[model samples]
Target chain A: MSGPIDFYFDFASPYGYFAAGAIDALGARYQRTVNWHAIVLDANFQSLERIRIPSSVMRSDYIRRDVERVASFMKLPYKAPSSLGLHTELAARLFYWFNDRDPQQSRAFAQAVFKAYFVEDRNIAQLEVLQQLCCPLQMTPDDVASVAGDSATRARLKAEIDMAEARGVFGSPFFIVEGERFWGNDRLPLLERWLDAGTY
Target chain B: MSGPIDFYFDFASPYGYFAAGAIDALGARYQRTVNWHAIVLDANFQSLERIRIPSSVMRSDYIRRDVERVASFMKLPYKAPSSLGLHTELAARLFYWFNDRDPQQSRAFAQAVFKAYFVEDRNIAQLEVLQQLCCPLQMTPDDVASVAGDSATRARLKAEIDMAEARGVFGSPFFIVEGERFWGNDRLPLLERWLDAGTY
Candidate 1:
């Protein structure tokens, strides 16, 4: 591969975690650098007109089916996340901190959070639960909390999301390689090929 | 492999056209019968009140990308049709007619209409264009027009669309194999695998 792959993710999304695992394999197979960008999905929705997409029964069904399909394809275990809604700002900010320090660790943290919500059916919204989840990463609770609440870090996170929206991002696990935006995780293979062929 | 694979399709959808070509091959590979059903996409929208998915500049880009992706995956020349939206009712009615008379010919006719609209970019909405395109199928323009205009056939067609909505159809190229709804053309391989494994 002749280019870098930028992966935009949010911890609240199970699909994002699914993409993380597959993306790891992709990085190894193709000659490319993967940059993980943590984004607050709720804040992004807020900026886009407080437009809470009304959850339709049809959409819910689709999500269930899609998660099953991808899990089967990737041969990963998946269950619908128990937590329907969680304030993802803190988790997203912590992701930013991990990305700066260790990208691989950030990926592990992403998977752990997904497992907590979807597979374990735990309520990740509780701060104590989130803190307990971060314990294994060796980052102190105070350190993670302080960074997550920092006004400057929050501003930077918001700026990153604004840039993503401006670049036409509509969903989680969006991949941008050389100005081409592959909106879903399913497009990762195509992205790899495009990179390998050095075609725009 | 032991049973039939119900293929849910909408004539107006380009993805449905792409999937129609290889559905038979997939069915053969898995030793499953592909039961093709014609549906009206617009009717489903009215019943569901689906939010008009914003037409991102990315829509066209994604379509082109998917065309290439699906074509390569199926080893077919996938081209974007120039003439976009065709009155799918005529096509659907024609399909129903041919399906009852000659199943093999019906598949070919469906493929032709799909190619005319998506690949050739011809004005499929125009009767003249449809007539020109239908010539190779050995069906006369009169034959097509007669069946398409029949009130009973139209009623039957409308009923099929109504039934699809009642069954929770949200988009085109949906596959219902043993009651499992696979929504997109991308899921074809997984759909086949599930059938082969007798998981459905």
Candidate 2:
């Protein structure tokens, strides 16, 4: 009788990239559906009144090292991005566009994007880069572009971000299970426990 | 052959309060000594150029929920402090003063301070409040004041904070295991794993 687990994230967040790899399998282990939502983080950062992390020297250094360490611990392949904090708005919009029709395809799209950024060190903010990523998912670059730029598709992505903020999701790789909010990739263990034991 | 785990924290941090409950036991499980250090966070926050939590409306609400949930998860008793961000400079300074002399008593003193702030909702910033805390440790209030007021003690505490900053500790409840840094209470599990089987 439980609802699907909501896994909200920004594609640009490396932690989000890390969470993406594990969340689905975790959901399957608990017999729950993992609903992936790629939402923009700019609005959340604005509300928190903080600058993007890669813009800061100290935080970025910590994050760079932490990501590598976390990747090693999680046993996921990770390479530092050539550029950090690349704008993820287009990637998010395309995810909603694909998700509206096919949830499975959208997840594949997300994985490809994550690999492109974290593993390949590609600049995901560029349209050509994103378009090249679509080929592996069997998505046409032209079709991907058209849908990502559609007004309705943009609106859908915006609404998701708005809902995330209203739900008090102020960080990436956020999860909500039956109204309980757990933020950050670090909280995944707690999320798994909640899904398994229905919270303490 | 294992080194003492350096557990750095700030008294005013809620996460620090939560971590204090379990760090020593975790160290014991691995047969490692937990060396507690109450370092100032103001310098780190200034370097990061960010306002402290509990000062922000949205963040404080999330933290209140997070601490309670984390406490429930850890099976520890917790109550939200009536006030937030009470200055802990005096508490930290006194901790170093006592720690230099007797490591055991300083740890007990720290536990008392954590309980006073988190469980009792006592404002720990007050000198008299700290004096009252020392009584339980069998130290007279005057004696507590004398050591905390010593310029040499204050200088020692400042030096610790300076060293922590240089080592790239930018958050409370920070841990360094075998020359590797892990920040936040959320990283405790990773720290435990590193201690048990060595790092990946």
Which candidate wins on TM-score?
2
Model 1 steric clash pairs:
B81-B118, B81-B121, B82-B121, B83-B121
lDDT, each prediction: 0.71, 0.82
Across A29-52, the per-residue lDDT of candidate 2 in tens digits comes to 888989998988764345543313
Per-residue accuracy of model 2 over B1-200 as CA lDDT, tens digit each: 48789999989887887888889999999899889999877643444423133345323565668778788888777898888777889999989877988999999899899989988999998989999999978889999889878898888888998888777777788898788787888888778878977864
> What's the lDDT of the predicted structure labeled candidate 2?
0.82
TM-score of chain B of each: 0.84, 0.91
| RMSD per model, one decimal | 3.0, 2.6
Off by over 4 Å in 2: A43-59, B43-59
On a 0 to 1 DockQ scale, where is model 2? 0.40
DockQ of each: 0.29, 0.40
B1-200 per-residue lDDT for model 1 (tens digits) = 37677787877676787788778888888777888888876553464546333323214555566566656655565566654455677778777777888888778877887777766777666667667767888889897677777997888777877777777676778888777778778777678778877662
lDDT tens per residue, model 1, A1-200: 35778888776676777887788668667767888877766665542322223445224766667777778787777777654656677777677677778888877777777788767877766666678788999988887677767997787778878887776565678888787777667677667767766663
